[model samples]
Target: MSHKEALPKAAFQYGVKMADGRKTRRTGVGKRDDKAKLDRELQKINQIIARRKAEAADGGGVGTPDYKRPRY
Candidate 1:
């Protein structure tokens, strides 16, 4: 039988119980949303930082690297 067709009924029963609980963590509802949003923003900032670092590495003028002096 397929794995999808072999799931235990106890799992479904637990899911029902978890859904019925107002503060059940098993459902993972509305948990850490702010942290997730912050992570997304951090990822964006890191992407921008990487782009700037690459531009600096190619001898283009955006800003001086932390370990280098300004030659201009």
Candidate 2:
């Protein structure tokens, strides 16, 4: 394949954050009833969900912070 064809076309994807308060993606606490930190982190995750909903409603969606548009 040509170099231009092999290059990535876009660098960002729009989506909600699904990581836990541990700040790791696709992970969650093992037990639900025995940790204060888990409770706090779950609350924080809920806050993030609410914020993302608000952004979607307002059409404030974006992909990435450092992506520069291709010059035409």
lDDT winner among the candidates? 1
User: Candidate 2 local accuracy as lDDT?
Assistant: 0.55
**Pairs with steric clashes in candidate 2:** none
lDDT of each: 0.73, 0.55
The TM-scores of all predictions, comma-separated, are 0.43, 0.37
| Poorly placed runs, candidate 1 (over 4 Å) | 1-31, 61-72
Clashing pairs in 1: none
Q: Judge candidate 2 at residue 63 and give its lDDT.
A: 65
lDDT, candidate 1, 1-72, per-residue tens: 555666689998888887888455544545677779889999999988887777678876547665685432
- The positional error of residue 28 in candidate 2, measured at the CA in angstroms, is 23
The per-residue C-alpha lDDT of model 2 at residue 14 equals 17
Please give the lDDT score at residue 45 for candidate 2: 90
Scanning candidate 2 in windows of ten residues, the lowest lDDT window is 11-20
- Quote the positional error of residue 12 for candidate 2 in Å: 67
